[model samples]
Target chain A: MVPKLWNETIEEHRRAVREAVLETTAALVAEQGLRGVTMSRIAEESGIGRATLYKYFPDVETIMVAWHERQIAGHLAELSELRDRPGTPGERLEAVLERYALIQQQRHGHAGELSALMHSGDHVTHAEQHLRHFVRELLTEGVQTGEVRDDVSPEELAGYCLHALAGAASLPSRAAVRRLVAVTLAGLRPQG
Target chain B: MVPKLWNETIEEHRRAVREAVLETTAALVAEQGLRGVTMSRIAEESGIGRATLYKYFPDVETIMVAWHERQIAGHLAELSELRDRPGTPGERLEAVLERYALIQQQRHGHAGELSALMHSGDHVTHAEQHLRHFVRELLTEGVQTGEVRDDVSPEELAGYCLHALAGAASLPSRAAVRRLVAVTLAGLRPQG
Candidate 1:
């Protein structure tokens, strides 16, 4: 068996290589569209051998999927942190929705093709499920505090927030996105 | 120039052929999905000769675009008629939103591929503009009657309603679609 120190160093090197690969591919995709990217180009740009790149990711499509997974994970973590932070349930919900809208706004024109490719598969479904649950929990908490409407179930309300916020993709400005989030939140307010 | 009788006959025939082509192509797309459709199949199914079909549309894509245009026109007309019917402005708005939500609900799994193909063109842009204006007008009238919240602009509220109702596309039942419309309308109500 390898020594403990040797094993730790190897694992760290592997993680570093994976991170470099994901970041390099994302930058290449940004510079050139998805169609313009290739595995060999990624290998060259990342200063890794083509054979080694293949070992890490078999193709450009796989690399894109990995990058998208990383992006989704990061966004979820950010929302989760915001939800856990000190704030009223209403405030937390607003912060999470704003972040989500901004994320959608930033994605406009940045990855239309990439999104079409990445939106399929299990990862996306799982991520959507996780997101829905996260938002539902926040709304549920708000309802308990009398900050959210009781007429709608938290599950349905979660769907409303998500679908409304998705409109941010076509919005021309961050201010428009914020307005959208505000309107959505108003929909969640307790009925008078 | 042709005589009046001859001209009228030719115009009627042209319209009938155009309608048949659009309907046939839509049916083919529904039955076999977008990829499986073809110009020859459309011509054969519509009972129009290949030469005659070519004169009407250049290819399958053009036929699909024409079909989509007709569909949008029909939907816009339906919404307009509902809006113009005898009712209070608030009731008219609810009728329009409900109809739109039902349309989205019925569209689930119906022509997703066709929608992606048809969404990018000038026709879609104009249709969206018309829709936004229609909804905005309804909200403006509602605000005049003190039925809608005045804090948000009618234009922004129009965006919210549309984006929120679009959630109907994924809802599992007509009941759920109605519920979505209710939640969206809840956002439009005057704040107490």
Candidate 2:
């Protein structure tokens, strides 16, 4: 049996190694494109041996999926915090979109690709589904509260909101994307 | 001067060559990915002479861009006809998204390595900007006519809508995307 101190050290080492994989994966994907992502390449990028990397992540797909999950988790966590804040459903939706817009602006171009790959679609793994359900719940709550328009369904609105971001994030400028979102929100609000 | 008959034949030949190249490129991209795109491979796939292929396109990038442009053109043509249809702005927006969603569904699994290569801040080409503008204009017009909400900007709404589609499209079930869109649309409409 391992000693207590050794167990702690092993756990800490595993966490560090996992983080290293994620960081390496992101950098590799950002620079060399997705094909640049290989077990040996990631191992080299992370300064870990191939065997060690495999010990950490069984394959490239696993790492890719996990890396996506982490990025998504970060956004979902932040959005959930925003969701509970005091405001009407409209205000909350606005806040969420605003936050998304700001964060998206900083992502250069991968925001759409990454977001698209993660969208609440059929390929969604469990965590992606969680994000989908969370957003849906947020919209449904808005409708339930009567702060959001009743004529439109939350799923349809959520789909639009997501696609809007993916396409907007791919735009050349934040200004361009912002203008697009402004018009869409104007359309989504209750007509006078 | 070239004979009129020869000129017509030349034009027809050029069109055929372009189509062959496009088919080759699409198949290659679908097979080996963007990295796998090469002039020789395209020539091989399309059964065209290398010299003839070069006469039409100078480089791989140019060929791919041209091919993508053609794809955009088809979608744009569809949009133009839809715009002429008699409908409210809201109806038009819904109709347009429905068409887009259908197209997206078909291409759902096609985006992978090629997309990852272009998912950068500086990756927006002029054609992509033009497409975004086209969609944004549709949203803007919808808002201007008071058929859509005035709260959100067209750019933002477009951004949101695109994001929603990309995100939701990632799901395993295409039907889920449809449901999501329907729900979101209901949420977008005005309350009684």
Candidate 3:
């Protein structure tokens, strides 16, 4: 029983170290361009020994990929939580878009390089499908509530919403992003 | 008068040679990747002497940039002509989206490389502003005609239209693109 408890504690510690390494690598990549980041620097910034860091991630590219995966996972989690929140269908969608835009705003610099990295992974395709499904479910709810246009299928609208909100990633300010979201939401209204 | 005509003929020849060089270089880059292209190969492929090609363009990158400029110029011309076509505002907008999607479809195989080239130019920014203005004018006309929602500024809706239609560049098929356009147009409708 004691050995099993010790093994569980060790697993928790390993997980924490992995998390620290991922965060540190992302911060380093943000401060310096992806080309400038190195394994030793990540080890130093993350406060893990070089040997330990190697055990967690073999190279800087792997760490960046892992960090991006974590970022995507976190976004999906937030979106799912918002989707379940108490509100009208339209309100929930608006909330999700605003939150999504804020996240885009937060990811200002290095977006081009980061996007290149993001798409180079197989995980991106899966993540995109997950995001599309999430948006489609919300749109279906909105249609049922008569808040969204029923002429178009939810799948098409979900694709439109994603493509439209993508512009928010490059918008200059939060106010601009909010305006962008408003325009996207306006697009979802039932036809007069 | 004879010398003046000779000078005009010389200028025309220079323009033809320049256009040929640009086209040949683009074709070569398409056949092979950018790294395989060189000034000698471009001159040979263009059927121009190496020295004359150098006079027109210093290297492969310059030729590629010039080719991209011509492509953008052609697109802008097509879009402007569509914008002034005799139709209802909504019809004009749909025509523009269809043409735009066709253009995207035509640019299928080398889109990644071409986009990389397209974004590396200052002219792309100018082209985007031109496109946004073109879409904005259509939205304004649609609003006046009661075919579009008037609550949002034409500028905001124009942004939405561009972002939403940008997805056409990556869609797999013509029918899918048509569906995307229809959904985007639905977004522009007056709210019920």
TM-score of chain A of each: 0.88, 0.84, 0.87
Q: What is the TM-score of each candidate against the true structure?
A: 0.84, 0.71, 0.78
**Across residues B1-192, which tens digit of lDDT does each residue of candidate 1 receive?**
779999999999999999999888887877887777888898899999999999989988788777776777789999999999998899999999999999877765537457544653223646767889999999999999998899878988888898798788778888888878888887788766
Of 2 and 3, the candidate ahead on lDDT is 3
State the displacement of the C-alpha of residue A126, model 2, in Å, after optimal TM-score superposition.
2.3
Say which prediction, candidate 1 or candidate 2, comes out ahead on lDDT.
Answer: 1
True contacts kept of each: 0.47, 0.45, 0.45
User: Would you list the clashing residue pairs of candidate 1?
Assistant: none
Candidate 3 residue lDDT tens string, B1-192 = 579989999999999998898788778767776667899898888899998888888877777777876776788799889978899998998898778766765665553455444552223556667778888988899999998888767887787777787767667778878877877777677776
Q: After superposition, how far is residue B22 of candidate 3 from its true place, in Å?
A: 4.6
Q: How many residue pairs clash in each candidate?
A: 0, 77, 0
lDDT of 1 by residue, A56-137 (tens): 8878877787788778788999999999999899999999999999998887653645664565222354666788999999
**Top-TM-score structure, candidate number:** 1
Q: Where does model 2 exceed 4 Å of error?
A: A28-45, A58-62, A85-97, A109-123, A150-153, A167-192, B24-45, B49-64, B82-125, B135-192
DockQ for candidate 2: 0.30
Model 2: share of true interface contacts reproduced: 0.45
List candidate 3 stretches off by more than 4 Å: A1-17, A38-60, A120-123, A144-146, A173-175, A190-192, B1-65, B116-124, B144-147, B190-192
Query: What local lDDT does model 1 show for residue A21?
Result: 91
- How should the candidates be ordered by DockQ, best one leading? 1, 3, 2
Candidate closer to the true structure by TM-score (higher is better), 1 or 3: 1
**Tens-place lDDT digits, model 3, residues A113-189:** 56544653333556667888999999999999999888777987887788788777667778878877877787788
lDDT of model 1, residue B59: 89
